[model samples]
Target chain A: MDLHVEGVKKVYGDGPTARLALDETSFTVESGQFISIVGPSGCGKSTLLMMMAGLLKPTAGGIRLGSTPISGPPPGVAVVFQDYGRSLFPWMTVGKNLSMAAAADKLPKAEVARRVDEALTAVDLAGTQALYPWQMSGGMQQRVAIARALVVEPTVMLMDEPLAAVDAQTRADLEDLVLALRDRYDMTVAMVTHDIDEAVYVADRVIVLAAHPGRLIADIPVDLGRRDQLTTKAEPEFVKRRAEVFTLVRRPAATSSAGSDAELDGRPSELKA
Target chain B: MPDPSGATSTLTSAPPPPPAGDKAPTTRVPRRKRPFGRRLVSGVSSLWLLVAIAILWQVVATLSPTLYFPPLSKIFVQFGQDWFTGDPSSLFLSQHFFDAALPSLRRLAQGWGLALVVGIPVGILLGRSAVAAAMYFPFIRFWLAEPKSAIIPVAVQIFGIADSMNVFLIFVGTVGLIIVNTADGVAGVDRMTLQTARSLRISPFTLYRRVLVPAAMPGILTGVRVSIGVALILMVISELYATTAGVGYEILLNQQSFKFLQMWSAFLLIGVISVLLNVVLELIEKRVLRWQRREGLSGQ
Candidate 1:
């Protein structure tokens, strides 16, 4: 189903020193689309995602999944947080974690077992179900987090920098895992990331957000053709697109008027849109 | 597809052909077993250390018999002859074990049960509500430092020289520890977990049963462990003061009659019971925290 975030604004504190974390920000993800949001640190990408996940209520505006208004976390949305160690229960085995989510949804025992097997195999973690989270390496723990989310068969998966804690090589492997799973499940995903290459590599469309009173500054499509870790990064178009995103991200307020659509760094706003 | 055993194998294995490939289903291999010799060495090492300590104690007692030391051999002989003869008339088994040890165990159960029943809910309330914590915690803290054993006279005055006084003393001594631990455990649950549960739309009852309890379990277990020791101490102290039966009273009776051997034996019994209790608790802790060990190595 299409997810619509409608003019959601979030304010922290009150009066004088009050900060606007999100200012009338809005976006949409068509069904079965991969959308990545990239911005400078502290630009409220996480806050926006949390609002959409129904984890946090927006001070103003709202989010909707098709016809249903998201008063709180939507029924079929699963979140993969960065700290896998904290997100999954330390007392449960990897298999139990998946089963718990399935059981929570009141799935039958047979269905839970089938989904558990499918999720573990999908993440290349089939045999390690009996292993505890701490027994695995950092990358493996994160995969289990992904597996847990997948077991729920969420329609819209919200991943907040899920690969930020892994080694460089492992990060690339997990990125490919995401792509493979996306194709297999036909799932809609909204991932918040600070990595420019990652945003361009994984996303069908990349949303560039400005810092300080965080707002959507650019919405660019990344048409780098078929993606593989090595081949996609090697493409000249990949490098060009990443450089464009970096430039838009680094644009200072002085260069662009507050209300006008003046182009920054001589690159037309058309490329961004 | 076969499950890789180690990091090296996993890295070398081709990423399993995309999910659609018609590869045979993977089977998991059994984990490698530790070498028998290594397992034997670890098992014997722990027992050897205890044996070494016992031998050293025996050597010291044999060489210098003057002061207050008894040889390990003599102690064991006395223990075996006194308690395990299967003789119904034996002082150790008949009078000491039945009359004294059983009474102490009974008193301990009564007091600790009361403490748990009263302390846990109160602790949970204080832990969850700041106003409740602020109002009650200071008074509780003030009482914790005061010697509950010194109130034996008051207990006797109120409940008389009966099981009631023994139970009262244990409750007074141990309830404080239980309350403090329970409150800390409840308060220690991570804020993020609570937020996650709330966002998941978990019902209030399920939130408490599943999230709050599990999150607070380590702390609660710790409290239970600490209180067990406290309960044992209070059981002995209360019996020593006014009770006519129990291990503590037996120790006092033997001391007064100049039966030093019997007094030492009673003390030994208490020590052995405490150690055994602690070992049982350790096993339970290990079972509960098996998953905890697998969590990423953050500082304890």
Candidate 2:
């Protein structure tokens, strides 16, 4: 189902102590689309993702999955957190952790087992079911985290910097793994990342946000024909898109207060002019 | 895009498939499975200092041979007479073994068992809920601070010199520590693990059972170990008051009658029993915490 973040705002505390974390952010992630929300640190990208997952409520407006407003964690939504060591239960074996999603849904024993095995296979961690997360490498543990999300057969998979902790090679491999899984399952994915090229490489469209009360800056579509770890990234069009996002990310003011100066100038030429 | 040059180097290399035998780092540290004879030899080697201490003790006692401090050999003889000597058909365990040692063992079990059964849930409740802890933690802390020995007379008054008084004293001595350690364990549960549980939308019951309890187990087991020691100490103390059948009572009876060697034998037996009980508990702890051993996270 499509996820709608309609005029969502999050302000922590009250009155003078109140700090705006996100300001009237609005976006609709079309069903089955691979969307990446990218920005600088403290851009509230994670906060927005958490709100979308219904783990956090927006201070104003609302988030809706299809027609349902998410007041609490909605069904058919799974989150893959950044810190796999913290996110995955160290006591449980990889299989047990993966199967937890299915078990939480109270699926039949046989069905849960089947889904666990299937999800592990999807993440290329087929035989690691019995191993603990810490026993494996960082990359492998993140795979277990992703496999955990897959077990639920979620309509939307929200990843919060899931590849941030791994090595560069491992990050690329996982990036491809997520893209492959998205294609195979036709999964709707809303990933929050800080890496510009990473956001451009995997996402069908990239939503860029500016920090200090995060607000949407650009909703640029990535149309470099097809994505590849090799040729697609080397393409001129990909470079142009990456530079565009970098410019938007670097110039915080233009995106920080959208259209105010544009209305005065009668043209928003400062960005993508 | 990282310099495509360096990034591409490892791009083609698939993560080495988990090794066939023990390639995974988690599987690398094998639990030591020493042969029985070797384990015994190692055990004996580890106890050499204690053996030396025993020899020194024997030498000192032999040289002095006071009425109160009799020779080790005489005490060993008394010990043999008290528990080891018996008819050939009774497996050489004397009547004193069944009377004195059995009751003591029974009381220890009852007291320690009650402590665990009561302490764990109360601990988890205190750890998880702020209101429950706010209401009860100070009370528990107060109880812990107060001398447990002072409660013996009160217990004797209520239970009237029965086994219940002995069991109650042991319970009083140990339960508070268990509750505290268990609460610490519950509080120490990694934040991310709780977040994972919340994300999964697990029920409150399973959240505690599958997630909270196991996470806090290592701490609870530590509490159990310390509580066992406390329980044994309280058992001996409680038995000294009005008990007639237990090890402590035997020591007091023998001492009052001026059978100093027999009293020493009871003391020796109590020491041996305490060591044996601790060993048993350690073995059980090792078995229960086998996974922790693999992670090298266990206290042992």
lDDT of 1 by residue, A184-271 (tens): 6678999999999999999989988876656787788888766777588988888888998999787873453234223322212222
Q: How far is candidate 1 from the true structure (C-alpha RMSD, Å)?
A: 6.3
Q: What does DockQ give for each predicted structure?
A: 0.27, 0.28
- Candidate 1 Cα errors over 4 Å, as ranges: A15-17, A234-237, A253-273, B1-75, B87-95, B196-201, B295-300
| Pairs clashing within candidate 2 | none
Q: Write the per-residue lDDT of candidate 2 for residues A206-231, one digit (tens) a residue.
A: 99988765678889998865567778
lDDT of 2: 0.82
Off by over 4 Å in 2: A253-255, A260-273, B1-45, B86-92, B294-300
Please report, as a residue range, the 10-residue window in candidate 2 chain A with the lowest summed lDDT: A264-273
Q: How well is candidate 1 docked (DockQ)?
A: 0.27
Best prediction by lDDT: 2
Q: List the residue pairs that clash in candidate 1.
A: A134-B294
- Candidate 1 lDDT, B1-300, residue by residue in tens: 344322213332233333332222233323569999999999998799889998998999899884345787787776665445556555436443766688888888889988988887778777888899999999999989988878889999999999999998999888888888888998988876776565445567777777777777787778789999989988998888888998888789988887666777777888888899899989998887666664233221
Candidate that would win on TM-score: 2
TM-score of chain B of each: 0.79, 0.82
Please state the CAPRI-style docking class of candidate 2: acceptable
